[model samples]
Target: MLKHVQVRSSSSLLRPGGQKADTLSINSNMSFCSLHEPALSSRSSSYTSLNETQSSTGSASVPAAPPTTTVKVYTRCLRPDLEYKTMSVKYTTTCRDLVDQLLNKYRMKHRDPNLFFLTMEVATRSTGTAVRTILVLDDDSCPAQLQACYPRADSKFTVRMRHGGLVKVYDSVLMAESQYKSLLVSDRTSVDQLVQLLLTCYKSNESVHNYSLYEVCRTTSFERKLHADDRPLAIQQEWSSLAEYSFVLMKRPPGTPRSGRDFPLRRSFLQWSRNRELASWSGREISVIEERRSKSHRSPSLSLAPARKEGEKSFYI
Candidate 1:
């Protein structure tokens, strides 16, 4: 049976340690040898294929980088000419990014980047009647998101010097009677600088010398005034204090003597008459009548007057 089982041997498989066993198995059964040869070859091919597949998978595992996006924006300087500027930035670019770019570009052209910042006036309503100027904060979102707040696409913006602050709406007689000037002052501006701003409206020659910032409060229609310390950004507290605030610019007449307090209690004829009438309605009212005369009275005369009857006329003897 071994003589009849003639097997072809491969020199590569005929190693000194392994050929004898292979030959013996082949010689034992010819049909079994044929099936075993294919199995051995298939095992080697499958191993090589697995190694190639692993290498291919290893190279493919590194993820590809995601793409970036950019957007274009336009800016206008709030000036006589309304100078225009254009910029292209990333989708996630912020106010700081645009401001820095603008500063650099402006410096290149005009050679001055100091105090300039990006700003835009956003309309408060759909009818485009009123608008508020908002300083583009560093952390604020991109122009696309800002458009949602502003709503008007054609609305222009400005790159101006930081020079103003927000003042709260107060319902005082002075504020109601006078034209409401929205004072937007820079945080770095001094009280003296604010006095200069007030001078523009009042246009008094003595404004620079006499005008000063005051802490003015009116409780029950009695106006109380205090001299505010002169400092840079003195009214910073009032700058953001939307409601609870009492600050005013008062222009004292030239050579007019001021007491310990800036605004003294001296009633005019009308104010005195009004006070008298109001006191009569209250039945019994103690009144401090401050009578002041120019040069005649060195100081105001303060006298406490007892409540009089409706028909009584008192004499100062």
Candidate 2:
């Protein structure tokens, strides 16, 4: 009887060193050797015509299996390597200079979504989530607030219609009710514009409008936690500040009487009144009501915050 030796290509097999060769089995019906140990295999074949076959096909050649992929599944602050408790939510400051104040205040990355979410949920340990209250920021009032909030760019304060609710975006001097009763804007709406408007109220020559980013985030988070209404959804320009923008997260103006509008806002407002909504973002609500005076009450506005330094504008983004 001719003995056939089996060999494994790699020496790192799970079996112990000397024990591998002892467990090798032999079958006379098959001439092909099975791998139990590679370190001991010697080329000792003095047999009939060699035959190589796979169960699928008795082919002369067979290919090795392909390697598996190793993509890292991304998750929150918890590092798989170590252990820690909770992490505060983070929100990205505007691509503006004021963002630097926030960025420095909390060490975060501009591109990190986890860190960004952490920023949005910060310091909301107390208070009502739906902050209907508003702040009025006059030109002089805004300048002081801007200096206090962002002392780095203490001298710069400008307003643009980029961020805020529909009212904030259209609150442009051109769209001012004092200038015109109502103006139509076909441009797409976004929550980034909503937050930008709040910054404006924080700084200005005339009273500016303002509030906390957490409120907006909470409004958004609430929608995520609850479903929108069954009413036919439509974007109506003339409704309350919340209903004006199509985005699901913009804050509803305080003390403003509610009216039937679209799906999410109407539904969210209902949830808010019932206290069914999560109030985790109440602390994020800051006052801009004092800033709502003068021409600021006219909604569909923009931000009164200063523009970014040319190079810095692109940096935060």
Candidate 3:
């Protein structure tokens, strides 16, 4: 959607007594000032005469550069369920303006205007490195208009609620033990936040202090575990990039051996299941007999084989 902001007039003229004349006035939505051209021409002539006088008197007047409204930015909400909103904002638009617009478009029941904050999720041009989420300070202008923040591409901004003692987080995906959980986390949530969220979701008797978060990334051959760090944005970025992001709870550091007793029970159970499945299979199983019968019928027989080829000897095995 396109939204236009009105610009103040910059056209001024010089008066007869070495004073400035009234500034030119334009309508709010005026594409061009349609005032009498003759009046404008007279004002320009007077302004130019004053400039000539200034140059002859060894003083020069420098015209002020007109303010620009060239920047138009597109912003999207991080909320998956909400319809994505793309707005064209002026370069002079403040962060507060964008935040208000976002809130108005998607009303948040618990969001406090005073506590609202905006953050940007940034990624490098290359896929080798992970994305970074940086806080958008309210006092700062919109990063979308700044070339330094996003040099080659546009970034999505996320809304966060911050109270004196509490933080409102964005939507995040967390997986554990073959179960998927979508939860909201506090801004800049660390390992503690993950553990707390897990404890609440699972209703586990274990204390949060006793738990440690270990990230698990899987490959075709095997799974690798990395120690979860305290960086919230880093973790959020990793979660956003992955199709399936999960963390496991381990009593010890990853790669440590499990208790011997548990392993025997698990192994015996798996073996028993395998044996039971094999025993349940019928001898007439189509896959097993079909290929075998095909091979047997195709076997070359000494007596039934074709007669010896011309100039070739026939052998019996």
Candidate 4:
């Protein structure tokens, strides 16, 4: 919604000094002071002679500058369910003045004056990076009145989502980790979420030490017991397992050996289940599927395109 902030002298408390005077008075004493002798028509020539004997002088005072009132104007959609968020907001000149007026209007009327920290942030748009001045205010202060004062303030002073840009995050979570426990496959993913995912992890046992930003944007995996789905493991590269901060994660179920990407197998693994009844009657659900690539010592140009257009069918899932 379009917000309004008005700047007028008589209606609001002006910008520190822009207050207007209700009346004006000319100095009447100037007429009788005899500082300058009145012109003599027929009767006033006597006054010129009196001033030469007068010992004191009086001066006229210059009028003070009028006080200006500014109000700040801004817009926000209230999402009451959100917790404290480190979101970006912008203020125009109108909004800044509004905030300034609001700050002054809502200061302390109690036994103790309200204390707050004023901090500002700017909009990051192609319009060019502008700096914002933060004017902290007391809780439940009357922002409406503040906006009422500086109606003509600039919109550049405040920030908005359109002005800044989208923010991104990477992390992992268990589907039922909310309800159960399971293995730690690579856990990384992004939510169209705010700085909240971080808070959620912080509040729970889910840790970030295991998270990593990768070649792709992000990678995430939930536990099997909490297995939201049974897709093959993500394309885990050799480096994924050998990173300096390698996690001693449990191997995936042999029945669900992760596929895709270039990976190697060292120790042999068997399909085994923790459940006794299920372990007794199983055979390898394994199948052979070969991937052909360019022979080594071949130039990249030749290796880039495979020797064959494609391969025959492996198996139908």
Better of 2 and 3 by TM-score: 3
Per-residue alpha-carbon lDDT of model 3 for 126-214, expressed as tens digits? 56765665646563665456634574454555566553233222222223333444445444445555556555555566655554544
Clashes of each: 6, 48, 0, 39
Q: Can you give the lDDT of residue 21 in candidate 4?
A: 46
State the C-alpha lDDT per candidate: 0.47, 0.29, 0.47, 0.28
Q: On lDDT, who's better, 1 or 4? A: 1
| Cα error, candidate 4, residue 255 (Å) | 30
Q: Give the TM-score of candidate 1.
A: 0.28
Give the least accurate 10-residue stretch of model 1, judged by summed lDDT. Answer: 262-271
lDDT per residue for candidate 4 within 141-197, as digits (tens), equals 433334444433422123222112212222233232333222222222121111123
Candidate 1 per-residue C-alpha lDDT over 170-210 given as tens digits, one digit per residue, 9 for 90 to 100: 22223347644455555554555555555544444454556
Better of 3 and 4 by lDDT: 3
Q: Each candidate's TM vs. the true structure?
A: 0.28, 0.15, 0.26, 0.18
Sum up the clashes in candidate 4. Answer: 39
